[model samples]
Target chain A: MDNENRIIITVLGKDKVGIIAGVTAVLAEANANILDISQTVLQEFLTMILVVDLSECKIEFDELCERLNEAGKKIGVQINAQHESVFKYMHRI
Target chain B: MPITIHPDEILETIRMVELENLDIRTITMGISLRDCADSDGKKIADKVYDKITTKARRLVSVGEEIQRELGLPIINKRISVTPVSLIGGLKSEEDFYQVAKSLDKAAKEVGVDFLGGFSALVHKGITPEEENLMAVIPGALADTERVCSSVNVASTKAGINMDAVLTMGKAIKEAARLTQDQDSIACAKLVVFCNVPEDNPFMAGAFHGVGEPDTVINIGVSGPGVVLNAVKKHPDVDFGTLAEIVKKTAFKITRMGELVGRVASRKLNVPFGIVDLSLAPTPAAGDSVAEILEAFGLERCGTHGTTAALALLNDAVKKGGSMASSYVGGLSGAFIPVSEDAGMIRAVEEGALTIEKLEAMTCVCSVGLDMIAVPGDTPEETIAAIIADEMAIGMINNKTTAVRIIPAWGKKAGDHVYFGGLLGSAPVMDLNKYGSKKFVSRGGRIPAPIQALTN
Candidate 1:
């Protein structure tokens, strides 16, 4: 996969219902494909990681990020969508 | 949906940026001004301004765009030019001052945080025009906001130029007096160097060297907080293990610098020069190199074993950084600037750190006697002597060292001088009362060391 067109979406906050639904809704609206998704709650804090393919996204990368941020705000979470290359470069050899 | 990267890796990257102060310190565009020279001084200033503006027009915008796309914090976008003294035809002091104004105006027009290279390379001896340029540095710095100036007074190939060293000392004091109302802020923008790096991406010392390409992009990576956290995670590790932990963390940090440098270079269509693996600290808490030292079981940063700790940290960073990048230049080590690091400031305030200790620390790390403040009434001879001592260290060791000391006019030891922002506040440290007047006033060059005959 082209890492340039992929985005890593991280959601961090208190665990709650519809945390996934609220975030996925924004991605679905933007036509961004979820390649992988993981969620865990440790010590009452929610940590969700999503690998989204942005090649088919209807909106620009910045616009999708803003929309996801707003959706996270509505659901009382903090969302950050960063290009996947940052993670790959930092973690991989 | 193929899962390639582990979730832990993604989470770690996020934590580094969000929690730790991991950032690309600066994206510096080095532009050569050789072609901007002219026989007339006014024409030279105009040409310099036009060349810089046209070359770096989209630097800030492209930097912001990359910052937005990667979700990475790019702290500063800056430009470095060929040393102004090399861009000839500026014969008089006013001519040099005019060139300084042009550099500042061009920096502002292009929206860079600072523009370096209002500089001269007088390591061996000074030309008349270079002397004139040095004469106007204090006034030029006081008059301009974004322009930075540096003078190289010594190198291994050319021993300490005591004449230039003395001149710079007087210039520092005069600059202090000129901007006393502002806590001698002008001195903060000036640096006195011994073996200054031409491709240095860090500010107050960066300048486009003559050997470089017409234009290039250099990156300075900073993540003292991330390294601190990594070291803290293994509080009980042995020295070797601790060094390995720091090495791994520095690898990750330098990789980010490499990635950012590549991206910025591609977007700006400039040649990628090098990634400076410096653990540069800021005034912000938890973002200090000194705190990283204290994290190594030292009660205070300036206590015994501080230099050893700093040496381990610096070597580990270079080991990790060199493996990550093909080209690593500049002063790629830990920086211990007093005013700019909160932990260092506290160490000085608590009497744990002194200028002498700081000088010792510089032998193991990068840069010498950085961002230190002394009494305003301190004589120029003393300042020159301090510079002479640092220059000797650099010349002997064959490494880059610089003095950015501030003689805060009207401020004595225990008093603080505030420049705000990254030029943070510092307690005016006490200096040795003995005068070096007789020694410094004997003006001549200290002949090059035997090491220079390596060829």
Candidate 2:
């Protein structure tokens, strides 16, 4: 009901090609803009942290997760999308 | 700009990351029910036990489920009911054993591991019924399993009850003798407390007092593993950085405690008590508060470096946990129970640690002088000294604290007492045998210090 426009998606698992491009392309097609990005590879584990603006996206948070889930299956990674508020509460407060 | 980090800073940070694996071995729930007015003492104990089992039945399972589902492991699920002495007063004098039996049965039925309440608090004086219950305590614990007990013989608020304290000192010896076949393991289940808090989520001290509501749920969250992992992550961080890292990580771990405690209370239908953010270390590898100290630049715990590092970690954990939850109470800091911690057990075995060093650490942490193993031949006066030193810290600091020492009967110094499971094991250490005359002869109250009155 509140600010449903913000979202954060974390992708983990394998490290390969076009992950950033593929996810960002989906967001770009859905009209979402990337606000912040941080990624690291710790001991062969690929971890990506991202914050995105999803107001203009073609689908909602659930729909975006669904689409990302599909792409995740193809890329051999797990992509999870949570609302920005959940992410903020988890990391900030 | 590049952050400039010193070599000492880097080493300190590494030590801290390594420390996070230790956790508060347990958060025991004390439920007080002095108001149980059943005409039959049996029914009263039954009702009280039911209220506890009903309130806490799902505690262990829920904690285990959360450990797997949420990845936040709860080290123990325990309940402390009202001190039996209060309910089976002189009026209800005839029904003490039945109450103990009913209490133990109910605890086992509900899957609760440690049920506390078979206790009497004679800080200033003892009544006939209180005396009777005190006599029963030695036998109650020896005959039954799972029921842990405690007595508050000293308190700064009430001053020390030397008469009752003397009685308990003798009682502990009798308990040790009674359970000598079990290596005096039953004595290990009893605690001598000073200024005992009503809502302690630890055992043998957790008895639901009469003052508590019908049913309430309290959770103790352990994050030594998290802290250890964080310390390990920053093999290059400094002492200050390590402190900051441990604090932040403790903050997150306490938050997990806050979340799970609230959720468990809601699910089980009980009010939530404090989220004790104690880094209760365990016997498992990497789960030692001593290791945390080692990670903080001390080669091992019990050295000069150990005290300051433990103080830093303890204070930071309290500050962070208090910020996370408003109702935080009990001994809400790190714990250094010797028998339960692997690194601590190793430290004791290695001769790098001593009882005095552990005492110093207790001055700044949650509980004082916990789970230490001493020689079988260690005299009772020394036990009083061991307790007196701990009680002094609590009385002087005006905090709740206790001492649970196991004098492994027949097991001399350097021998090991292995109870296994969460009780872990402890190496029986050398102790002073000369102080019996001085300690036991000072039979009067250890008067409250002038500093205690200022507050």
Candidate 3:
């Protein structure tokens, strides 16, 4: 990783197969390294947490959100980036 | 880890708990602006600017950093300075607007979000300078974003000043008119009080009184969310058990309050004031003092046993918070403002609480007659009477009490005044139709009886 930044992306929606694999495949194409991943299936709900290395990625955060937005639509989920600054400010000041 | 409580059950109970529960409402830094007092106006203004900015430049930034470092949400970071009247003396009319403009400029320089020294502690009588400042308040507040103003018209020891009350009633009307677009919200930033404590952490009314040192720090710690969440957790817990829950919660929250307040005061090089443990509520969905009572299963507050229950909670909170923080003063009881609190508004709207009931609650609470809204035509005499009555309660009981009522212009009883945001929207509650002409007229220094002052 040539960069020092990572974004924690969370996706939550109706549980379906291949959601994780599909999202990871998209990240692989972008040359984004998935540093850590966590997924939980509760009842009919699926929640995913992904920390991706963005140092070498040739995309801005907004573009990443845009890419994830399409994946979210295909998987019937809502995808959003947690504003690390607000979280860091609120909890890690 | 050995499993004790089930995670699902924990989430269920936590879900029952309010999310915003246990919030630190405010951290107020009190800086003395008296050093800026001078006959030459510009010199005074420069001193005022230098004193406040030097004393408080990093207050908000430090508080925000502390909040983040501790994962504690400090909702409001405010500065309370020496009463501007004390600086210029309430003598010259020009001093009023000029002093206000100076304060506005100084507060902006320090990056202090709100500077609250545009004050007149005229409990006994309004000095000429104080009166001018009072008259300038509406325009000062309407014009300045970072300036907060307050006037103390009554105190337990001095009794209620009828003239000041009368003037304040008119001032309220004027302030409401000035910020009419904000639904008279400028008044929300103001407080009229009996036995107003010198070291209150809340805004508009917070000012370093003449008696205070060159600089001091006071904290107003609030935890309505904590108590509400604590109460909601136990659906079947009786009042005694409920009191236990609130006490435990109060202890934890107040500890954090005390820690933060002490650290902030020390860092700012100011002496710490009392930690106000008032469960101040917000218009925001989850923060309501009334909802905590509702969770106790009274259907609503102000019913039979309402006073007893609230008194119990008030006492328990005081006990818990007192143990946690060394200094505890101001209106430290659960705040029962009508419009600013979602639950209290609901209770008032449902006829579950009355002004009389609220008065009874204030007997044991930190403040009396707070954030309550009445009608515009509610007679100056009636306003005086209400002030007199609330003052009597505070004076007789020897407690710090305050009244912030917005008599919405052109709005009558049962009409709602929407101030929006943190001020919330006040539902027009009715005041008695009778007159206080005789009582208010007879007011002349109701004398500080032996029972009035304590330490």
What DockQ, on C-alphas, does every prediction get? Answer: 0.78, 0.09, 0.06
TM-score of chain A of each: 0.95, 0.85, 0.84
Candidate 1 C-alpha error for residue B20, in Å: 1.3
lDDT against true structure, model 1: 0.93
Per-model lDDT: 0.93, 0.71, 0.72
- How far in Å is the alpha carbon of A80 misplaced in model 1? 0.7
Clashing pairs in 1: none
Highest DockQ scorer = 1
- Give the number of colliding residue pairs in candidate 2: 37
Q: Point out where model 2 deviates above 4 Å.
A: A1-90, B1-30, B57-69, B88-94, B232-240, B441-444, B452-455
B59-160 per-residue lDDT for model 2 (tens digits): 777666544333234667777877878874324444776677777887788777788878888777788888878877777777788888899877877667
On residues B1-455, what C-alpha lDDT tens digit does candidate 1 reach at each position?
A: 75577878878888888889899999999999999878888899999999999999999999998898888999999999999999868899989999999999999999998999999999999999999999999999999999999999999888999999999999999999999999999999999999999899999899999999999999998899999999989989999999999999999999999889989999999999999999999998899999999999999999999999999999999999999887999889999999999999999999999999999998988999999999999999999999999998999899999999999999899999998998899999999999999999999999888974556
lDDT of 3 by residue, B350-430 (tens): 888889899888887767777777876677677767777787777777777777777776777677888666777878788
Which order, best to worst by TM-score?
1, 2, 3
TM-score, one value per model: 0.98, 0.79, 0.78
Once model 3 is optimally superposed onto the true structure by TM-score, how far is the C-alpha of residue A86 displaced, in angstroms? 18
**Scoring only chain A, what TM-score does candidate 3 earn?**
0.84
Q: What is the DockQ of the complex in model 1?
A: 0.78
Kindly list the per-residue Cα lDDT of model 3 for residues A12-53, writing each as its tens digit: 788888888878877887777787777778998876777677
